[model samples]
Target: MFSNWNKWSIIVFIIALLIISPILTIFYSAFLGDTSLWPHLFSTVLPRYTLNTLILMIGVGSLSLIFGISTAWVVTRYDFPGKNIFEWALLLPAAVPAYVIAYTYTDLFEYAGPVQNSLRTIFNWEGAQDYWFPNIRSMGGAILVMSSVLYPYIYLMGRSSFLRMPISFYQTGSIYGKNIFLTVALPLSRPAIIAGLALVLMETISDFGTVDYFAIETLTLGVFNVWLGMNSLSGASQISSVLFIIVVILLTLETIGRKNQRYFEKSSGQNISSIIEAEGIRRLIYSFLCFIPILLGFIIPTSVLLNFVLKGFAVINFQEIFSAMFTSLYIAIISSILVISVSILMITVSYFRSNKFQKFLIFISSCGYAFPGTILAVGVIVFVGLLDNFFKFNFNYYTGGIIILLFSYTIRFLAVGNGAIKSGVTKINPNLINVSKIMGFSFIKILRKTIIPLIYTNIFVGVTLVFVDILKELPMTLLLRPFNFETLATYVYQYASDELLEECSLAALMIVIAGIGPVILLNSAIKKTGKIRKSEPLIY
Candidate 1:
């Protein structure tokens, strides 16, 4: 037993260390007495970057909660005209990448866009000083674009929590003549709401493409500006360290909040059908409430992209687009497989064999998901630079290759794979493993025969999620991909960055298309997992 434990311990330790190396490199580089550029950055753009980041976070978080929680509550608590369609249709936006949405919105609302053009023609207005119009490249636009796609995180988690609420609670609220939604549902769903908000906020902070195109001077944009514009990796690392600390603080608050609050209820053996059904005007209102999000999130942007593709069909490059599509698919597949394997191995060993300290290390290793991708990419660059300097080797030879890109993806996305597998792992009976062990089965044999089969559903869920995420990934791929390498993301980014959405519309559409299937599969898996959990007998 001691030998087996040691073997697993060593493996888990190595995996955790590799996962955290880039983050550690960022911190290490930040403190290397790099003060030359700090003064310049502080005096010039740091404050603006910090302010923009805060505003973006606040705006995106607030709007996403509004969109996500409202829609989730309505769907779970009441039966509306299109409640069934809205339940799944609301999730479609999750398939669209934020950058792609940003591009489509820009294409549809910019000064020369079709909407503005039509309005001018109809109203007989002139060029420069036409009627008032909202600029789709401002901070407000960033919030709208981000919230449209990101709200699903909140919706998915919040709806699940609401659905799992014991019917007795609603009955009691009715007896007291209290508003069930405000008095019972909202308070109980706090954890899920916070969890989803945390994801949205983290993704908001990590975003680069949307902010870059909009020219919003957020911290993520500042990280890139410092790295590339000024050629100061240390300064960039310092900024990244600040960003890392900010995320750590946010996550710490979330953890502390969760620890202080707990919701418990006896099962009523009733599903969401027990909730009152909306009728007539109420039903129409509920349907419209859900429709607004779907329209802004998926339909309008998709229509715009489709329009671009239609208009540019004659000039669209099938060869290069297909080539990029194949590349994106290939990398997404390989990286998802590699990430899921590592996540399962690390999470399993941590759960079964590790000490408290080892478990803590494992927890911290997943913190990469909280860092902005551009910052994380910079960390990878710094780590690789150290390796190159120590070994006197050209690390660029590898950094410019697919291997580094995959490693970066693993670092950035390990959390997704880990979270899915860990949730599945917790539901598993430890006795099954102990029984296998008592039969003189090897640890590997136990895992293969028992654990793997039980967690196959979760493994698929994680794989699908990681694959879609990789497909839509932009910053890390843009920074680390090999010369002449073009994923669908980078391919679209080239044209989108230049505001030539018409040319890259087909490629951008393909990214969303690739993700749609996986997104649906993931949502189904989550729903199935929730149902299975609810059906299980409480051991306590």
Candidate 2:
């Protein structure tokens, strides 16, 4: 028994150390003081980057909340025309990457594009000063494009929380003559809403493609500019440290905000509230409200890409694009497997066998999710560079290779897998493990025969989410891919960055298409899990 305990303890320690290595490397580089660029950055661009980052976060967070919560409430509480379609359709945007949407929007709305050109022809204006037009490559444009794609995080969480709430809560609010939504639903759903908003904000802060494409001077952009342009890895690390601190604070606030807040419904036998069907003008309004987000988020961008493909504008290289697509799927599958396996082991040890110090290490292991991808990629570079230097071996040869890329993905996405698995772990009864042990079942035997079967749904969910994320992942793949490596994301980014969307529309569309299957499967798994739990007694 002691041997088994020691074995798992050492395994968990090593895993946590591996996960936290990059973060430590970044902090070490930051304090090395090798660069003299700090003063210049402070005087010129740092403040602008900070301000732009804040504005982007606030704008995206607010808009995503509004879009996600409104749609979630409508879908859960009220029935309208095409409500069934909207139920799953709202999640379609989650498959569309923010960067792809940015490119498609730019293609459709830029001066030489269809929208502006049609406007010019209609107004009979011949010059630049003919009329006013909104630029799709500005900060505001970044917010809109990002919020449209990211809002589904909030919607999924909010809808789930609403579905789980007992009907009694709403009935009580009605009896007290309070607005059920404002008084009961929103407050009860605060934790879920905040959890989703936190994810949105993290994604916004970590985004490189949209902000870079729009030429927004956010800190993420600043990281690359300082690293590659100025030849100052240390300065870049320092900037990343600042961004890292900001995300940590946000995450901490989210945790503290939920402290001492708990919800309990007295009755477990009550069903959730029935949906109210809309009629007449209300039906039309509901339909339009639901239609707007899906149109902006999924339909419009998809149609624009389809138009590009149908018009024979996109560069067709079926052999090369197909090779890249397969490569992407290969890596996503392998990395998802690796991440989920490690996440299960670590979470199991932390929950069942670890002391305070070990648990703290597990917590640190998950912090990589809070760092921007580029920053995390840079951290991996620094850490690997040190290893190469210590052993007098070259690491650059492997820089863009699959080995490094997969390692980076593991570090960046471990938190996602951990969260999904940890939630599943909590639902399990501890006494079952004790019983199995008393029956002479070893830890490994219990895990394989008992725990694994029970958590299969969560494992599938985690794998699907990580797979979708890696498929659409850009910044890390951009920085760390092998010299000739080109995933679907990097493929689209190459042409999109050059403002040659016509050349990459097919690839861009493929990324969205690839994510759709996994996302739909994930939602289905979640719904099935919810149904199973609904039949059981409520537990905190």
Candidate 3:
């Protein structure tokens, strides 16, 4: 039967090929690697890398949960002064890349920096050993920096869950003389919080920038160390495979825990959720809590960059920075469009078709984001090498040597798109599709008329996320881009890799500025959708 299936099959095949090729290359490399090295890895670098990665994950995970869930609960439930602004402001950190934040924070908080210098002069201290200060280039610092920017993933998801809850649950808690916030809202939002936590953990595990900057030696760091330091792509792929195993286990546990659980809104009429109003002291505390994250995530890093920009010593070539900014914007926008469109298509098909193989394929495709971008980029390089060789021999043709890097980006970033779209699909009621089908609407018609409009906010969320990810991308772009091609990320990384951050401050600042537009627009769209959903029935 000719249906959307025929059309979708062709698209899905291309996407699946692009998504799976790098992984296949990594697997082949791993299979061919010397097993003798595994024992040495276990005895030497493996334990330290695994322990540090686990510690960082636990630390960042705990902090992000606290910051994300508490702030989400406070803002969604209570009406305090500036609560309206806090709703969107809490999301600002989502715009700042963790690596850029790391660079800015290092400049601001290092011992030779203004704060320490002021302390030394005031306290009459002498040399390096005069007093103790916390190091921003350590594991603890990595956790702090990562949590500051990453918690918004949880916050956005948690708050949406909180706002959707029926008021009757809170009223029932109040009737029983229970703490409504803790007893009613938190429990109801647990699934969402976990989902957000899952995203945070995946991002943390895949993170290379903060760990590399802090010298924390995560699994991702090990992948780079093994590949570059040991000159063994096979060994690097082996390490990446281990990281991938951990992610699969974690995701499996989360899925099992959620198997029998449900979050469907009750169908009873007039189920409006009530907003709690805070008093004087409570209002001040809530507002302060909300501001703390912004202070750490955005204000501090931004202030430091601004300071350096103002300093005559921090020289910047404005024309060079502008060109880099344009390149970054162009690549980020194009890549985001591709990722989001493909994600929406995959998610819609996987959800409605109920085919086990297709579902598994999509799941495997998204796991790409769990691997370090650098490692994945290497896999892409190997795969591309093979493809180019085959093409040159068979078709007497060569790959668009430059364009393949962009394809590699699509492979790496499909997860951000798939995650957002899948979450959107999960939130929708399946009955809507059945109803549409019963009404004689074709699958494509139902998708175009019902699903697309229903999930446009999700598409934007995925777009904004992929855009920022591409903006901050470094190692992958560095290795994969055409010779002489420099996006802002690569431009900044050149100076940053050499620790000449001041020289690249303008490019870094441009990344943040470029991100600002999408961040604001996505936040607005999410909030608008939530408001509309609140008043409407719980129809799919």
Candidate 4:
């Protein structure tokens, strides 16, 4: 059937197959072992795990919308005091991981912590009988923690949508004595909100650190427990299949958003006019609105970690910490380079050379990112183990699993690289690729000589972002790393899980610091969004 396909198309298809092979292995491995565990799982842990996962997704999704949509609307709609500062500062929380924030909140709100202690001092009450305080380890707490860090996805997307909407829409709402937000802005911004919410929900379901630390028993955590606690690989894969279904639905939501995005494309280059001039009480309210999410997501957690570092700075374990830091940086850098290389090849071919089937395959391959890290790790391990068995080499998990890490990381982050490459490719002259083809140059030669140089900036952006993501990654690094190997993320996880968070505070802080670069880039991009006008082509 494919005999007429060009070499480039075949090559792209094979790469997509390699990228999707692990996901295939996951479904295959689910049926390989005992079939009896399914009843037990469904009766006991599976129902609870599934319910908790849904609840977490709903809770986090709702809260992220409130935080993200509220802040986006406030910053874009009202001219409040400190409005300029809030635009960029609101994104700071994206730098902190959910698990890190969970650790910080646990200390701040626990029974023996300063908050309860202060309350006790004021009310002259003592011990556990005094009053009821919310547990930071409960379902509600998990929602709060996850939402704080994840809301930036919605904020960024929604704000861009709001800015792009025609001012006439809001003006019409106002002329009719309607709330512009409810009547116009919110309605027009639904696609962007759903897109962002899909991302937030995906992050919520994929989370292992916060759910695991809080003992919430989400499906992601169930995969972990079933695999390690019960030593049943098949059982883990079955749970991962459920998580896989959730991911597919989220992808559908994203697709719907993307399809409708063109409908709201900015029609005019005019700036969005602020409807409300925040002053006095309104200014205070709007300012406080922006402050809360920032306070919860970035400030409190960062401050807690900073306090720990300051107190422990003298006796910090510089040797071990430095080693783990180097390891994390090394793996992240190498994995980013590989991901970008494949991304450039696949995206260039898909856009410039490949047919529809090849483009579809390439697109499908990038969906690896939608899988939870644990689910993807299980898939990768099963696939790699099969390869090891067939090859009969000394490449077991104990000795040579770095290859597994690299492979899995490539799959997990390839979408980030592809997005960047696609953005860059869109701006280049398509005639350049055609001219090379007319001269009888192969696709590879044209790609090397023409496409790569034009996209260097985008390549740098993709690699930098992916490197930071891998640096902060926990589930895959926790489960699939070579024996005795540790990244800074795993290092922080180990110490924090043992209630020695102070020991790992420095490493955790470093991860947060590295993430700030992406925030800076995003802020710069947002600044330029509606400012410059594209010159119309005279030929068109």
> What digit string (tens of lDDT, one per residue) describes model 2 on residues 131-223?
889898998899999999999989988888887777788888999999999999899889878878988998999999999899998999999
Candidate 1 Cα outliers beyond 4 Å, as residue runs: 1-5, 267-273, 393-400, 529-540
lDDT, candidate 3, 1-540, per-residue tens: 233355565567567877888877877777675666687888999899899989998999999998998898899878999998888888888777888888888877798888889999999998679899999898888889999999998898788777677767777898999998788878777776777787788788888767777788888889889988998777887887788777877677556535523555565564557677898799999999999999998888877777767772437777777788887888888889988888888888878763666677778887777666766876886787778777763322223634666677788888889988988998889999999999999867998999989998888788887888788887688666766677898887777778777778777777777678766865776676456444455421
- Give a tens-digit lDDT track for model 4, residues 104-197: 8998899888899999999999787878889998999999999999999999999888876666677778899998888888988898899999
Local distance difference test, each candidate: 0.85, 0.86, 0.79, 0.88
Residue pairs clashing, model 3:
none
Model 2 TM-score, 2 decimals: 0.93
Which model is ahead, 1 or 4, in terms of lDDT?
4
Task: Itemize residue pairs with steric clashes in candidate 1.
Answer: none
Candidate 4, lDDT over the whole model: 0.88
Best TM-score goes to which candidate? 4
lDDT of 1 by residue, 1-540 (tens): 233347877888887887788888888888874778778878988889889999999999999999999999998878988888898899999888888899999878989888899999999999849699999999999999999999998998788778767667788899999998999989878877887888899889989889999999999988888888888888888888878878987787667646744655554465333557897799999999999999999999899889889999987888999999999988999999999998888888887777777888889888777778888898898887787678877555645568788889999899989998998889988888788889999878878898889999899889988998899898898888888899999999998887778889999888888779876875675566346354433221
Q: What is the descending lDDT order?
A: 4, 2, 1, 3
Evaluation by lDDT, superior candidate among 2 and 4: 4
Better of 1 and 3 by lDDT: 1
Q: Lowest-lDDT window of 10 residues in candidate 3? A: 393-402
